[model samples]
Target: MICYFSGTGNSMWVAQTVSERFRDNRLTDMADAVVSSNNLNFSLTEDERLGFVFPVHSWGIPWIVRKFINRMTIDNYSNQLIYCILTCGDDSGLTNKMLLKLFRRKGWQCRHIYSVQMPNTYVVFPGFDADPAELEQKKTAEAVPTLEKIMAAIVSDSPIDCYLQKGQQFLKSRIIYPLFCRFAMSSKPFRTTDKCIGCGVCVKNCPTHNIRLENGRPVWANNCTQCLSCLHRCPQTAIEYGKESIGKGRYYYGKRKDSQQ
Candidate 1:
């Protein structure tokens, strides 16, 4: 089974590609699993493999993914080969190390871990924006070879721990990541501009169900994960994350069809 949480379709596309390479691989959305109780339990077959695919948030796992792991119950006995495919804009820091502890608590050994750099999507901060059209196209094209290599290793059951572009393990993950989780996840910064048509896209796409439409406007709850889905997926380019995202570009993968190239 490949369980994943994707805000803008980068991780989802990776998960779908990997799932298609194998037979009878179940795809579970971590966001939906956390909200729906019935989707949390899983019993993997003897031959089945387990995988976690998600985007790195603030150089760590997204809070929504952590929430799902904390709540879900997996009813399998033996130590099966578990792997993770992390999607990131640039470097992932020690996000893989953090994930290792999560599976350790459950007595599951995470055998292989890998990170792939996709287009940049986090734009709530200064000096961070989506990749340019050329760079975005480059990353998308480059990911195909990396993914193929990862799939080859998985097929052979090779123990690979290639976390490419993992920068500053101690400083980024151990120090900065915790602070980011504590103070950077506020939903109060989000607001719709005059371009908003109240189409309910943001309401429906929010992973945590933390958005609702009221009086033809989207209202945000305090439980946002800062996934940037609402900001990027807005059809009318309505959502903004404070002053930082005023003139920044929006990206949701499908918005650029060349991403699939």
Candidate 2:
């Protein structure tokens, strides 16, 4: 089974690509699992490998992903090969270590870990915006080779160790990540502009279901994980995260005609 939580489609693309590599595989969306009342339980077949794919948030995992992990339960007893794929805009701090600790607590051994750099989708903070067209194309293009390596590692019998593009582990993960979780995540700044046409795109694309239509405009709830899917996916480009995103560019993984596998 492959469990994933994607905000702006980068991780979703990775998850889907990996799932297609196998003839028989199950795909679960962690965000949907969290919102659903169904129990987070699954029985892995002997031949099926367990995998987790998600985007790196603030150099760490998203709050929704953490919540899902806390409630998740795998029924099978034997230790199957568990793998992880993390998609990031730049670097994933010690997010892999944090995930490993979570797995250990759940009595699961993670055999392989891989991180892929995708186009930047986070643009709420100052000095952070979507990558330029060339850079975005380059990152997406480069991800193909990295994903190929991940697929190869997953099928291998020998245990594949972790490989992470962890930059400033102590500062980003230990210090900055905690701070970001505490203070950075909120939906207060989300608001629709005059350009908003009551399209309901944001409401539908929100992974956490944090947006809703009210009087022909979108209203944000407190459950937002700051995924920026609503802001990036808006067709009119009318959503803004306060003044910081006023003139900033938006980005979400859109498959191009010439995109390579």
- Backbone clash total for model 1 is 0
**Using Cα atoms with residue i matched to residue i, what is each candidate's TM-score against the true structure?**
0.94, 0.94
Q: Residues 1-261, candidate 2, lDDT per residue (tens digit)?
A: 889999889999999999988653588989988987569988887767888999999889898999998888978848878888999988888888899999899998886877988998888888898899899989999999888877887887454543556457899898999999999887898888899999899999999888899999999988888889999889899999899898888788884433445
Q: Which stretches of candidate 1 lie over 4 Å from their true place?
A: 258-261
lDDT of 1 at 43: 83
- Show the colliding residue pairs in model 2: none
Worst 10 residues of 1 by lDDT: 159-168
Q: What would the per-residue lDDT of candidate 1 be over residues 1-261, giving only the tens digit for each residue? A: 898999998998899899988763688889887876655778887778888999998888888888887766779847777889999988988887888898889888877889888999988888998999899889888998899889888889986656865447788888988898999999999999999999999999988798999999999998788889999999899999889999998998767775456
Whole-model lDDT, model 1 = 0.86
Alpha-carbon lDDT of model 2: 0.86
Deviating ranges (above 4 Å) for candidate 2: 158-166, 255-261
Candidate 2 worst ten-residue window by lDDT: 157-166
TM-score of 2: 0.94
